[model samples]
Target: MNKIVAIMAGSVWKVLVQPGDLVEEGRDVIILESMKMEIPITADFSGTVKEVKVNEGDFVNEEELLIEME
Candidate 1:
């Protein structure tokens, strides 16, 4: 499994993919809000989305796992 982790502490602003969805490397999967700014999280590798570990509005710490892919 490949993990997509948060780059900074923030609240999940949006989830752009669901489990079973096909994704390409560098595709934006989640958007996070921090310091009143929006940050996008991208897939690290092309694969099927195995799981989304965080939900919208959920707060996450830097380096926290946000999504899994396989």
Candidate 2:
């Protein structure tokens, strides 16, 4: 089974992958900017990205689903 990991921080600056992209565990999927710092949201499991729930420069809240993998 696969899981979805959201951006834990509320700052979505860049989306690194698109739907149908193959992802590995610990790979950076999104880059977030908070307080002028960059943070990376990584994949929790090895799977293919099924969907991208957020886009580049989209403001997201904590625990907001950014990508779905399976």
Candidate 3:
């Protein structure tokens, strides 16, 4: 399994992947709102999404796990 984690502390603005979705390396998988700016978080590895750990509008700390891939 691979993890997609929040790059910074923020509220999750959008979730671009769900379980069973395909993802590519560097593809934006989540967008976070911090300091009123939209920060896109990208996939670190190309794989099928295994789980979505956070929901839209959920606040996350830096490095919190967002998605799992396999």
Q: Compared with the true structure, what per-residue lDDT tens digits does model 2 show for residues 1-70? A: 4655555565678889988899999899999888888989888889998888887877878887788788
Displacement of the residue 62 alpha carbon in candidate 2, Å: 0.6
lDDT of 3 by residue, 1-70 (tens): 7888888999999999889998989899999999999999998789999999999999999989999899
In model 2, the runs with Cα more than 4 Å from the true position are 1-3
lDDT of 1 by residue, 1-70 (tens): 8999999999999999999999999899999999999999988799999999999999999999999899
- Kindly report which residue pairs in candidate 1 clash with one another: none
Local accuracy by lDDT, each model? 0.95, 0.81, 0.93
Clashing pairs in 2: none
Off by over 4 Å in 3: none
> How many pairs collide in each candidate, listed in order?
0, 0, 0
Q: How many backbone clashes does candidate 1 have?
A: 0
**Residue 20 CA displacement from its true place in model 2, Å:** 0.8
Off by over 4 Å in 1: none
